[model samples]
Target: MADPVAITAPTTVLIKVIHCIVGIMTAPLPHPTGLAYHRMGHCTGRHRWWRPLLGTLLFLGAYLVLSLVLFALSYGVGAAAGLRELPDGGHDFGPLANTALDLTSIAIALPLILLAVWWPGRRPPGTLSSVDGRLRWRWLARCLLAAVLPVAVLAVTAALLPDSGSDSGEFGAWVGWRSFLTSLAVLAVLVPVQAAAEEYVFRGWLTQAVGAFVRSPWFAVLPQAPLFAAAHGWGTTWGFLGLLVFGVVAGWLTIRTGGLEAAVALHVLNNLLGFGVAAAVVDGLSSDETAADSPWQLALADVATTLLYAALVLWLARRHQPRRLASPVASSPAPAPAPATTGRTVGHHGESGQDR
Candidate 1:
């Protein structure tokens, strides 16, 4: 058996590197904002077109570098394990390994995003999490709770649909008590981080940066949706559409609640349930054959599920009011003028002025 230490050693090193980068990038820059990005123009005090452009480039660079490192580490682990390659020259690490790889890559984005917003834009790290410069844990808990029912319903719906591809056997062969348990453990630990990191990047960092530049909330919401969809490389028309809708709705929730908590909750629930079900029933979350149905029924079911989740979250938001969106630049009181030294003293209540 391959030593677990061998796999973990590289990961530890990568994590240390990530931490060092985050520390340096997040070290207190000026022009802090507690509000969302659309209202952050005054904080940075720079409206140059290049600011957003450069900021985007910086974020991409950080993400790409970190992702490459993670990929190399994962590849090294796979090579050591003697994992076999698919016919297409891709290694099949099964569901557990794949989930770990996906989540680790996603998890790395959180600090990078904080760096992107802080270093170049001169915003505080809290601004990336919420409009109030703080993450509302209570509200996030509520949203996560509200997301459960809708996601469960979607899961049931997907299960009821017939499997249309031969890859059903693929899941069965790869999935067993041992592998399932391992995948479950990985998902339990990393899925939340993965979901939250994505929300912070798309709905939080990228949206706000664009919002800050255009000074419009819609500008923040719309452009990021396609980019989010593209990130998935869903490989089918319906899959692309489904992800696009998800992105749009998530962005909307961010704007509506003045924070990323609601969107994060919805995403966490959706991924947790989706991946959990695949791991349990299909024995794998991905397959060589596109497991989608011919008429796009399953795809539509996924879309419906996402929409239902969105509706439930929105309803909850309305019932228990979250913080309204505010300007990122908080107003500070101006200092009062100093009293003159060699001047006549002013008397109160119509008294005569006395010379000092």
Candidate 2:
């Protein structure tokens, strides 16, 4: 797994470009290849010596290239159809995409995971090693601490805040129960894939790579936190914070527990529950008779929710003070003793002097 063999800069760039093109054209959604490549690029010192700076640059380039390609495709289709102007109403297409992205990620991610799992080695790194296989009780507690506390804090804050000028209003109604059920089924099927991708990136890949370089827990845990956060983009500050903090906690737990299973379990459960809550809230509050309006307000609420959620997650992590898992000590080698020296007797001027 350690690809220490030097990859020439030109080769890396060429591979990256090919990867971006293949990944984009093949998948309906952008492949997580960009993410995987970036992470590998950083770990391998291909990306500006441990900084993901070049990796980020590569990702952005890939993203831009992919976006342009998609735009061209759409434009071509639109032109052939004789459509001069785009639709005025939005077609957010969440339900439509639900199946493709989920299925694609799983279909792509699983084979790679299996390959990594089956590969023979002196020791499998991350939580995959036999010694680290045992699950810990405290991880479940941390999962609970992560999922519940943040939502509770956000709910309270939303309750207290005056319904200001905002736009939770334009939020559309849920798809039919059937559509929702289908989405749920797709999610259930894909949760493992999504969770595995995250765990592989954060706990499996980055944590081990970071652990190899840094002796201290902070150094190992700190770097991946922001990466996790930034991956969420400006989705919501609080949510971003929550995931980043959760990333740190999970990384620490993996370092301690020696397995990514617990982290994956917690992540899937958290996401499923969060999605369920949001769906339920949307359905329960909105009706044809009482439809609301406000875009800016919803945006504000999102920001607030992300911030509040992040704060709560960090607070919980602080309260728990989970340390890195205990690693077994290795046997020490004994020190070698100093070698003995014998001096040959020096000959004197005469035989009598030598005898005396």
Candidate 3:
């Protein structure tokens, strides 16, 4: 199979094109998610010229930074500990430590990253005017459903299963409060570094660029999902699926809410809770060499459960309004109507008319 990194860019572009085609095909119909925040005012309009380029730059920079940090930490620690005898893939690291680091980092970074995107003074910043007609309880319900449902189902199913063969990996006796807390502290530094970077690119940058340029929410949804998935690399099919679902949910939430705040909040929460839970589970268990067995069944169960969980969350959250504010068709200023007489000229600036 072609390496994911090699194909990620082309694949993401292709997905965007496919989504645009689908959106164009479906333009006449109502958007299915109970709201058309992206369609508010106009379904098609001129997009900012720099959107795609800016988004791509942000994605690349974020990825490089996070990758370097993780690599350095893992390599430096491994070398210092003289754990060359350690197993490949280093599954022996305490799950709690890994997870804690992940949660802390993401939780911290999400807010700051969003501020850069959503702050009032930023260029090309999304504004309240970009929001749908008005807030609706139904849409909120859908957001919650999409966010919570998959996780709940996965948790329940995982709880019910007997220790599967794949569950046997040892977290190593080296993990304790000090180690776990240290990892959490490191993650506290990196998770935000990672998570904020992701949301900024995928949700803030990519979603708007694709939606505006392609002229459809569905089209906007396409590019981000697979790119999000592919970034996980090959061994993590489960993680990839989780990211894809998350991308869809986050995209819809941002569109429906008419802003990125809700999606960012939900994403930060999900990452924090998910990693924390995984760490707790791993920390409580002892190291077992044979724990790593067939994970296919568990993977399937997790996927199914996650889908169910998302559905339930939607059922509980409120919906958003469907009406949209009318906006001008083009980016250029709208031409004024000719006056009845040349000397009876009237100048118009913005919404005001100078008829004095």
Please provide TM-scores, in order, for all candidate models, with all chains considered together: 0.76, 0.47, 0.53
What is each predicted model's overall lDDT from 0 to 1? 0.72, 0.46, 0.50
**Model 3 CA lDDT for position 344:** 46
Please identify model 2 stretches exceeding 4 Å from their true place.
Answer: 1-96, 99-103, 106-170, 277-356
Per-residue accuracy of model 1 over 128-202 as CA lDDT, tens digit each: 776666688998999888888877877788778776454345365445677678778889889999988888888
Q: Compared with the true structure, what per-residue lDDT tens digits does model 3 show for residues 166-198?
A: 544433344456655654565555554455556
Worst 10 contiguous positions by lDDT, candidate 2: 285-294
Q: Give per-residue CA lDDT, model 2, range 1-356, as digits (tens).
A: 54545557668889999986554323221112212211222221222333333333443454456545655665566567665543522222243342334334333543343233222211222223212222344654565456565445544654566655333444455556775676567666666566666676666645545654455656767787788766555554444655665677666555544455446655666555444444443342222111012233433553454445445445654666443332333334433332334323333322222323
Deviation from native of the Cα of residue 98 in model 2, angstroms = 4.0
* Candidate achieving higher TM-score, 1 or 2: 1
Candidate 1, residue 321: CA error in Å? 1.3
Candidate 2 local lDDT, residue 268: 64
- Residue pairs clashing in model 1 are none
Q: What clash count goes with each model?
A: 0, 12, 28
